[model samples]
Target: MEALDSPKLDEHSQALVAMNEVFQRQRKDYLANPYPDYTSRIRDLRKLAQLVQDHKDALARAISEDYGNRSVDETLFAEILPVLEGIQETIKHLRKWMRPERRRVRQLVYPLASNRLIAQPLGVVGVIVPWNFPINLAFSPLTSIFAAGNRALVKMSDRSPRLAAFLKRVVTDYFPREKLAFIDDGHQLGPEFSALPFDHLLFTGSTQTGKAVMASAATNLTPVTLELGGKSPAVVAPDFPLEVAAERILFWKLMNAGQICTNIDYLFLPESKVREFVELTQKIAHQRYPDLQAPDYTSIIDDRSYQRLWDTVADAQQKGTQVVNVFPGNEGDGALRKFPLHLLIEPNDDSLVMQREIFGPLLPIKTYRDPQEVIEYINSRERPLAFYPFTRNKSLRDLYLQRVMSGGACVNNCLLHVAQHDLPFGGVGHSGIGHYHGKEGFINFSKLRPVHYQGFIDGLKPLMPPYGEKSRKILEFMIRRARS
Candidate 1:
């Protein structure tokens, strides 16, 4: 099947046309049966599980070609593993996930028990996936969509051109084009995809693009989930373990060469603890992953992103800030973009790299004697998508958790929060909007319709007539109870 069926933006894709046709059929089935059937959803997930396991090699190969040489090991662990795990977890809990939750009613509806929420699937959804981890990003949230029993039309990244080609093949072979669809063009059809009358839309990409998506979604009044980037800070008070914090930050900061939305964007350490944390990370770098070019570490996604990272370093250098060299020979212009990793220190807030989300392998450090000042810095900017504080001390983690507002939080580590199937994943403020994963993931793509059933008995009708002894007594009791 052709990846892009439309010759121009005005004309849409044949794949997309085929997708709309499928939606028409699926929509009929959906309206006829709005309630989710947990068993059928589980069956579909089993098929998806088989597809991921069977196409593991092809998926990895495609991702590697897109990254020019991102190791297959990296793709398997980062992309394939997460997708399978999310699907598996959802399948294991589908029955419970589908059951209508019961909530007690007020005294008025005595003996007429109420089922609080019936999670109904949205008719159709559009998922805008990022290029960083094409397979995982596309399928992870998709698991919840399936678990909720909804149809999805996915827009694969144009950056991952090769992977797009391969993913399209896999998508067509296993699932009907209407049940599941993939778009593989250079963002030309993105607006059309977003403007489709999907019940809900989920977009994972940069903040700038997220804004555009929001504008288009407004046209149809479609509710959306935007998982965009931010300057997500990692704070380590004096109480945290220096060695553990260093290694934990390094693993995530360097993951996908810092092309992660929730990766530690920067760090704030106590002035007294700065030297100790920095030195320990330097030691762990040599001991744990001796070679900076190890197979486990993937390169930056594209040349444009690589150059953008280097530009941040250059701007910082011009402003007289010191750049922390994490990898040997990963210095100067020649090898910088090819293998980028840096521990950056700025003179102050005025410094260049300290300004915005450093979406690269650069880790900017700031020493703070007062944690409140750091908290103020966080609030000063737009709320972040995710925040981290690597501290074993309960008080410290709790303090940050209580004071700061973000999409999600992880204590003593990073990025692990996103994978926990029990929690929700999303952003706040300018970082992005809405979150969907696990139970929350399912609900985000569903409509929680409340059906209130009243029995034949019209008891408690005394309040409607002229006030009498029983009505007056009940009204007085209710008022007193409400005050108390």
Candidate 2:
């Protein structure tokens, strides 16, 4: 026979091959152990929490390295602490969540049958994590997945290579490759990763990318939970205190340099309060970040995002909007990607900053004379991931709450609802499609299988006969019983 050479596989092809192999291994493992016991699931969760505890500093450092300068406190407060707390909450509830519920038997079955609602594992789940809040986004869902007695394969963002690599290396110590694996984006394998036939998939990122992920997962008939971003709005009612609202909003708006998905994208200030809000924000911004170069302030994720923010400000200013730089004359260090916060006072609706989601430290203010205007304007667009109505007035608060629809909301505040482990965290409409956190998280990742057990009595015996008068009479009685 003549010697023949094998065809060479490109990088993506090889990555796909490796991913498929891991997927198959996980699938096979799931088949062997379809439903893990509570003890095993608890052990898995503990390992996850321990992994974070042991590697907290290193993980924070790697995240900081990924961003030119991510705040250490922000990483710990936003990512590390929240994840650990979520895991603890999941552990506390897993036992109750695992128990099957006794459902009432249908009247047709009567006393002859029993019904049960059992939550069973849904095999391996794939988690597509985003660069922002990488740790919490990845492991918070993982907490739910594992608590539901399922394995997972996490794909990390390309932008956070260091954290991805760190996770890939450390996750192995706690879990076998078949149970849990972290795949790096070294080969840009996000599309390939989403196409795998996992039991369920959870993706967290931009709305556009979420659509692509949903389309990819559809091919495999895989269910997905999308945590997408939109221009989440905050309205400061006239009844509310402007300075208090200013302090709270500014804290979250600048927490991750306004890179948060649920961060207030635009603010609706009462027409009379615009200038005071601007002045308060300027004072707060300067006080909080006196020197933009200090480590207390985080840099923009990359140069492209940094440039995009600056472009947005320029476009707004060119359109005659009043742009107030919180730190005047100190036009941030471009080398460090530290772009100072700019308050675009009443930017035009056509302006770039207002038209799109500003995922940076730029806030656009919109003046509103009536709450109805705020309601009408927001309802006209895609539903947001979050809505912030900062007012203590019960009627006004209830008015906004009843009218607006969003993935979630934080009254009198912003961005704190996501940190609550008890509440399910996901998006709505363009914002996202399903939820995952606490009990809801467990249910999202599991299949709620219904089980029926037949008893000694056979309720249908009298009805299952030849078509005759007796059968008709029994059916009539049954119908009357149903009506009753």
Candidate 3:
């Protein structure tokens, strides 16, 4: 009789198997040396810094190519610089973060016991990065993972194939597979990657995909830190200068063509200032981006995204909303996928532009009567990732800050809080789950195990459950003292 043949695996299944093999190897290596010392972690971080610095130009070019016309300055400032700063901050504070924290023992066990929290390394971490700011999202979390002394496996977005390939090559050159690995097969293996049993997982993407990733991670009981996106709003006070607010909001709106997760999705303008705000925004936009065809202006990521923006604008226009293109005559170089900015005035509540997170150069302006109305309007919807209030009044600032609920906030600026190395950046509700940046990032990837050390003396020996006469008398005395 002929021998039976084994079942053949498909390409995705084979990829899954290969990924699991790498995970198993990393797990084994982590078990062998569970905790890396401070010096070793610093060395690893320095190497990563060098890796980014040495290839900054190449990485920028690759990212620009992926987006067709991404601004090189934007990539350098928003992506590479933040990652380098995060690495340096991690190295600077790793020694302190790794030291065991001394905690106070309970009064009941105070005599012969002491308590402390040991920041132990979680064995393996999995990171799923998005196409926007791919390098920053990938390496910023990697800095924390390494600082926490854990191994990591990263899955890059399929939309950013060039950057993904470049990262894979550079990362492989710098570190071993057991230490750090990048999965650049695009989305073909994303489900398998999320299903792997990792000690911790961090995903940065849209809320819908974040939910799916969370569900996949649930099977393994793995903890997750999701950096998802939502409709973040910018509230401009009636008292503040219209030009300043418009310039600030417009600056962020056009950054990377408004692909950032925390970009101002809409504006809350006092009813009177709406017209002036629009005029100021148009002038600022024209002066800043004189020619939409210029390289300084970023293009939409792809045809699908480009068409989405156009459709959103059209839907708003059809719904009786006034659509204003900041650069009217300059439609941008269509061949390069660059599109001009569109500002929507009072779009219908049910319009696509108003309902969804417009991750593009489309801005919606909603008028408000009072601050309380603005607060209620924001609270009625799902919580956003960021809330920007531009006001000079201290009371108004405090009122908005206190009333509005979001993952993070900016007093008078936009998109600057996420860049702070000391801040914990994450979302709440529909926005995101947990945080990962600076010290919070370190703690997020670590297991804070509480340890109790006992001395030779046993203070509770007399209170043992023997139902003896001495035990009863002691318990009665303690109860009386507690009551008194």
lDDT (10s digit) by residue, model 1, range 220-293: 99999999987888898787777778888988887777778888987998777777766887787667556655
TM-score of each: 0.89, 0.97, 0.96
RMSD of every prediction: 3.2, 2.3, 2.8
Q: Please state the error at residue 476 of candidate 3 in Å.
A: 4.7
- Please write out the lDDT profile of model 2 over residues 364-403, one tens digit for every residue: 8899999999999999989999999999999999999999
Task: For candidate 1, give the lDDT of residue 291.
Answer: 63
Question: Candidate order by lDDT, highest to lowest?
Answer: 2, 3, 1
Residue-by-residue lDDT tens digits, candidate 3, 1-484: 0111214765566667778888998999999999999888898899889999999999999999999988999999998999999998888888899999999865563476888899999999999999989989999999999999999999988888998888888887889999998887654888889999999999999999999999999999999999988999999897888888888899999999999999999999989998898789889998998878788999889989888888888899989999888888766566888888888989899999878889889899999989999999899999999999999999999999999999999989998999999999999999999898999999999999999888667778887777799988877887888899
lDDT of 2 at 315: 97
Candidate 1 C-alpha error for residue 188, in Å: 1.4
| Segments in model 2 whose C-alpha atoms lie over 4 Å from true places | 1-7
Which is superior by lDDT, 1 or 3?
3
Model 2 TM-score on a 0 to 1 scale: 0.97
Candidate 2 Cα lDDT to native:
0.92
Best candidate, lDDT-wise? 2
Each model's lDDT comes to: 0.78, 0.92, 0.89
Residue 115 accuracy (lDDT) in model 1: 49
Model 3 lDDT-worst window of ten? 1-10
